[model samples]
Target: MRKRLDFLSLNFLRKIEIRYRLINCFILVSLLPLLISGLLAYGETSSATQEKVRVYSMQVVKQISQNLLLRMEKIEDTSEELALSDRLQNLLTDYYGSDEAASAQARSGISKVLLDSYGSFPYVNQKYILDRKRQVIDPQIFAPLANSVARLAEEAPDLNGRPWWTLYNAGHGQRSLAMLREIRFTGNNRSAGLLFVGVRPSYFFRIFEGIDLGYDSSIFIVDANDGAIVVQNRETGPGNADPALQQGIAASLAQKRDADFIAYTGADKMPYYAAIARVPHTSWLVVSATPSDKLNADTRSVRNKILGIGLLCFAVSLLLSAIIARSITQPLKRLVMVMKETESGNSRIRVEQAGSDEIAVLARKFNEMASKLHQNKEQLEDQVAVRTRELERANRKLEALSATDGLTGVANRRRFDEALATELRRAARSNKPLALLMLDVDYFKKYNDRYGHQAGDECLRIVARVLQKSSRRATDLVARYGGEEFIIVVAESDPGGAIQQAENICDAIFELKIPHADSPFGYITASIGVAALQPDDHTAPERVLRIADQALYHAKYQGRNRVVLGSDTVHTL
Candidate 1:
């Protein structure tokens, strides 16, 4: 038996003996623990640090967005006040009068007022008021930018139609964000002049002042509409931003207006993390960037130290490693089981252990990471839910507005068609009568010519309110059928009832006593036509509409301000 055992041991220990082999295996196994410990510690610390940096960057970007938005809103309010200012309106009104001395005085007074107002706002760099004669109201004060103004006017001759409300970066440091408004007469609402308000680019980009941006980090403002770089701190830092990188980032952000953060590679061939935010009520973006190498510096330091110590321990622990390695092997097996459980969708799983061993520290850190991940997921879901609700509410409001008229605040033609089709179907099902009345204001063209379009709109609104108030049935619908005409559909009403309803609507308009001087009648009145039908499946809905329209013409022909009924024969009331 001794001879057989010696032979077997010799074969097994050809390269090394069993004891030496066990020690070597132990040292190899121990290296894994050290490696894992260093990696886990570095990963936890690095992840935490990066998360903090990202959160801080987001806060900074959001604050900048809000500050810039507030500044813009202030400028916008000033523009509004200037547009409606009576003094400025009077200045423009008397600008072209025949008195040269008064005109000079008015120009002087206007320039002084603009200078005072513009000086009061330290942020505003320029202001201009151009009258209808294409003359600057204050040319002496704004002569420095005369070429730019002329170029702008040449580029857009129709400034009255499409007001410029964005940043303009004409080279030679003449960059400004402008708000253009049209000045109108208070009495006639006629365009008198143009009001131009502008503030330097520094006014918007000043939010970055005193911010503790890390070395080599950059912050910029981007135009969301055209992907243009509005402001940037690239010149102050290392010149690593290439035009391609900027263009790529701007294009990406312009397309993805919803994302708050995005990752990209910079021109320096380094990975970067960017935090982005949009200015409220404006098409602009605020972005900040940090290098990934800086974020991972501590991890690299820790890893290098662990590698040095690990190599030294590999040689030092070779002799006593066999015994020490057994102790950790069992614990590592248990940790592996716990990790497998977590890997199988059991994120709540945790290792049960005590003492300051590496395994114990790893278990605690793992549990912490799991908890944080879960919290972040829940927060993301909550934000998604909030955004979805906002979209749904916005859609509902759009639907309501689309179904109503812009001028009269009543149901529009689209809503009328839908109501008419639905009522026809319901009446056909139940065999009940449906009555439609078409109403037209008498001599509306003459009324519009006499009082102007603004007053004519008011007159239509008053008539609409009266019609809407008179048709107060649950199933009754009043809609603006066409220009200066309205349609009222009364469910379950006969011809007599329909004519009486129409007469009541006409009398209601008369009682309002809106003056229509061109009409033969001294007061505003409506001519209405009534058409009743018991809808059958074969009868077309448009036929009833046509009959009602023809009856309205008959009412107008039989002298306005009367109700006409349509059936086999038309009759006047």
Candidate 2:
């Protein structure tokens, strides 16, 4: 008897929701503190790591900037030394514009000096001595370099005296930067000629090879005189730095800052940091940046470790809860499956009850509920089908109302525009002729003044009915084109067909014999204009309507109650 009582007690505790609640309580007590502390530590570690990376990136940028400044200064000094040499000055003075052989010997002597001086420098791509016309003396040394110099000189005529950096865009997607300076004689400082120095940006960008600025990180060198990026390793090419970084570099240049950091959003819409530094002895800036996701990659591993341990604890707890709650949960799981089937339109499914326990009682209640729901659903579906049918009929009526004229019961202006566009396309595709007929009630304003508005409305209705009857084919349409103007669009119609239809419409309106005291005809009449054309690839649909309108004006100008062809023929119907 006591064992049976204990069994009942255990069964009472096996309810699924209750069992899971107990397991969750155990987990919260055991792992909550560990998780809280782990997350806090992770945050602190990530912040410190980011700060370190920011400082290190700035330092590396400044170091590279300084090295570049020193190299450029050395290069300038070498150029000055070559410019001041006595041999070059004497060669220029004695042999310039002389005979070919004399000039040859002087050129040979100057070339030797240039070669000797250039050997002292490590990164010179090409060096040349040019005349005032920017012609290289020894074209045989490098013909391409000579041509590039001539083109550069022609493009930048003002680059004489002061040092200048310029870009050369070679065809087939290639470019390079070069330094140019004019060489003058020593004594009177007379302009002897020019010197050309070419260097590839890759030579300077190689300095960043030893450092890693994280994934998707890039470095750029910007020219201060203009907001031009002089060098960048990005695949998009130079002068394409992020706008925020560009703005920050511009600000730094304006403020004359040596080094600084800027924070901005990256292309991914995530926060990013950049380090900016000025290269001394030159108007250049070094900028480096990386997205925050890449910068914080190291901290993510720590987070994954903490999360893995927490998930393992959760899995163990969930396993124990499932074991304890199996009896109650198993039946509930079947009930859930049945409920899903019912939701998917299978209303015949029901749970099987086994014992007189709480689960069994619940199963009985669910079966009864499912039976009632099936009956109610059938009645609801019938009512919904009826409602949907009524709605469809109402919508069709609304569409007809929208497309029909409210006053005259003809096609409205919107329907006319749609039909005209459709017919134009069809005619062009089929290489057929299309026609447009525009009609206007003669002296419509005067008619409205003499007759009442109700009489005017009735007259318009009569005209609409006559126009509708005149449209012989189902594909043709007559539409009220606002006020007393009406349009009739006909497809597959020739010029003769259009003129015949216009004549018919004019005769029918005149036969009505409605009295018009103010009209010149002594009765109501309409002027009809007919325009027709064979639609081709080059034909515009609007041109036909404009022609018809012009013809209508011509008809009115000649006399009322007549049909006018666009070819300027006035026909009395």
Candidate 3:
């Protein structure tokens, strides 16, 4: 009976292995076609998406460039109109008058001309005259030009008989693009002065309408002379130029060429694709950028769809595999359940086979295997538990040794230093006060020599206990700081409060009365130094420690058994 059962079990196990192999083969065969189809689909979609993105980006660039050029032309035309205005001509003649009354009357006439011309073109902002000396003749324009003339004088000393256009950084939150045209008066027909028309940035920014770029996308015009951004779409807010994008745009301007579609970080530290084009008529560059993800949205959608189809094909293959695997695994499921129950100390379950195939043979062998596994499980569990407990104990010992001071049974200097740094950082960020106390056992070496090394250990333990008890707050820490020295960190305490706490700890250690007959100082006690820190003193935690250490050195120098406070003069021990 046993032999027959063994043979049946072997045959059933062989049939299960065969079914597994067959299912694997089916999966491979099915997946190969699906994978190939997915790759081909993804490749086609990627190509199509890239092409679409290229076409769309090029179209956007062209449209934006045309729109900007048209706007610049309109501004140029308006500038020409101001240059030819009869009123502007009359105002320029009066502005160059020699006498104070004549100059005052000229200023009045020019202000009137500006008010009249400003009504026609609200974007004019201001209009003024530069005299033969290139000095601003209009009081309204004098403020921005007064300091700027010194700078411009260095750049261009002889501004006579010249028609020049330049951009200037106007004070009072304005940037002016000015055009200067040399004018000859009707009487002398000699160059008398220059006519200047200042256009505000809003005049150009008004053209950036009806564009559907993403919310983060921005369009800006920068002055080529100094690389300061002159005009940008106001809707983008101020300081929206990311340094990386600014550098890229500056490079493009320096090279005097358009940049490729490149990824860059924006002012907000978000990724974007940037392209720059130089303006034709001025020393200015136009930079247009959109979020990189927005530019590739269509491509991502197509790629997602292709991946989705691939997943669907994989899902169908898995479903078919489950159905085929179920036929061979049905009997094994019951056998597994019986085996699990047997493992839980119920070993009387008998295997039942549904068919006369190899499954029947496997069923009989499963019962015997379950019996053997059940017998060995207890011993295996015992060994595993013992090994786990030993490992856990070793880990605990390692952690304890890592944190503990070998000599004093308190936290070591390493742990104390880490805690002090962390607490100092926390106090700084929270704008709170923190204090440190340095304590040293008085005449520790004498005590060690009198009562031996074992007694020295007992003395350190007693001092550590006193320090631990004195510091009651959860934020307070007492640490053994090398041989015969200890330190305490007290958080959220002021100088006076820290001094009292340190004195209390000193008295506590003195009360312990550890024997030190051979010591220069009578009973065993500690000299303590206290220092407090405020939020503004961000110099380092170690600096505070150095201050406390200096105070402690003074304490030891004055006497051996008293507490000293940190101040302008270190308090005596």
Candidate 4:
């Protein structure tokens, strides 16, 4: 054996093993620093980039909101001027005689006056004058504008004399901001008519263009009242907005608060950092969004540079590791070869400890360690066998305790829940019926009060035994559900079969006839609720329990000591 082993245990193989170990250690030490530095650099860059993006986006949103408010103020001023005009008042006061020709002349004059007033303001899309009766006087100036007149009439119910501005959507994909003011004269202090000025949607669009959101960014106006996109630099298709994001925006608007840095997907399928600010003068939402990728572009560049430096360092370390590994492994090669030879029955070849360092000490210790290890091998085997037998016995005891209820000496809640879950799954898979009966001792608190606590415990144990005996099926399980409540799971049983079983259990408990002199209700009784499992995979384990609980509640309401089945027409019981 010694001669045969000398051929297989060569010196070269030992040197290769030592070289591989040294290389592994070098690689780990070199890469660890590089990994840590790269992670720290990436995290810092990402955090700074996110902060900068948030600050800039907030500034853009604020500036846009201010600009929109200014424009709305200008429109309001124009509306005030139009409402106080003398020409509009005169048109409202002049009521023609019932002659058709005179009425035509007065209508023509009124339309010309309104056209001139509207022409002064380029933002005004249309203008109208209504008489005291809310009838249009300048009908030609607002051609095919029936819908606009009707809406204004509805809005200005108290047309006695008041001015109000409202924003609304005009048909054909146009939104208009309009102001309606009642016209009055000195002698007739009451309102003679209403003056209206409608501003086109372009008025808002032109204001949104001045703000500089980067090339990939966009600014839009949404009508808060109707959730309509009023003016958009880049239009999002219908229903493309995230429902959760929209809900959040709506909630913010409802609360009359501003929403900042909300995440939303844009028309271009890119995620953006969005901020929504409500325009104070109108029910308009000014939204400014910038592509998140653009904001993080600088951080990504910094990360790439850091990774490049780390890779260079790693390459240099790897090269140095190879050189160091070769040097350290040369001496270990001889020691390892001698050890292999000794292990294979070549006892003459002894290792020579050459240095006064840890490695040399380790080489000397290896011989001593090998001899002691051989001596203790038999003892270790015996101890391992003894531990295995002990573990097996412990596992069996644990399994038995797991299945048996600690309180009632019957199946535990965990076992009952598991069995019911398995039966439910099987019933669903095989299209078979599964039923569960939940039973609770009626007036249990009263019983505990009349009798001592000890008697209450004994009563519960007796009830558990009766339930166990009543469910005679091999597949049936009786488990003590928390306190005085107990549950019985019956597999492959229909609603009728479950109900009969529950009734039998209730009767068996009554048959015990334990004397209860302090009981107001003659004898101790129980309420049983039974429910059949529906053959639906989505039906949860708790569904049967809930139904049974509901049935039990109904049984108590009807009268105690009665069994209630879930399938009965009287669902309350």
Give the least accurate 10-residue stretch of model 1, judged by summed lDDT. 8-17
TM-score of 4: 0.44
Stretches > 4 Å off in candidate 4: 1-29, 95-105, 120-123, 141-144, 152-189, 235-243, 264-272, 291-294, 309-573
lDDT of 4 by residue, 295-362 (tens): 77777788878977876666556644444434445447867887788778555565666555445667
Per-residue lDDT tens digits for candidate 3, residues 1-573, read: 646544444444345555564656456655566566666776777567545554555556556666767865675565556656777677676556567686687776765555445534646655665576767665644454655743543344344554455665555555576655665765667765555666766777666677555535666766555566767766442333567876776666666565345567766666776656666655666666777666556556666677667755565566434444454566678788887888687887878865555566778787677668767889999999999999999999999899889877788988898998898888988899989999998878668878888889988888888888898798898899777889999999998788888878877876777667865656898898788878454658657776777678667756768777776455443
In lDDT terms, how accurate is model 1?
0.73
Error of 3 at 428 (Å): 70
* Cα lDDT listed for each candidate: 0.73, 0.76, 0.68, 0.69
RMSD of 1: 19.2
User: Model 2 clash pairs?
Assistant: none
The pairs that clash in candidate 3 are 8-361, 9-361, 242-267
lDDT by residue for model 2 (138-189), tens: 7345466578777886665555466666665543355566767788877887
In candidate 2, where is summed lDDT lowest over 10 consecutive residues?
Answer: 8-17
Local error of candidate 1 at residue 308 (angstroms): 7.8
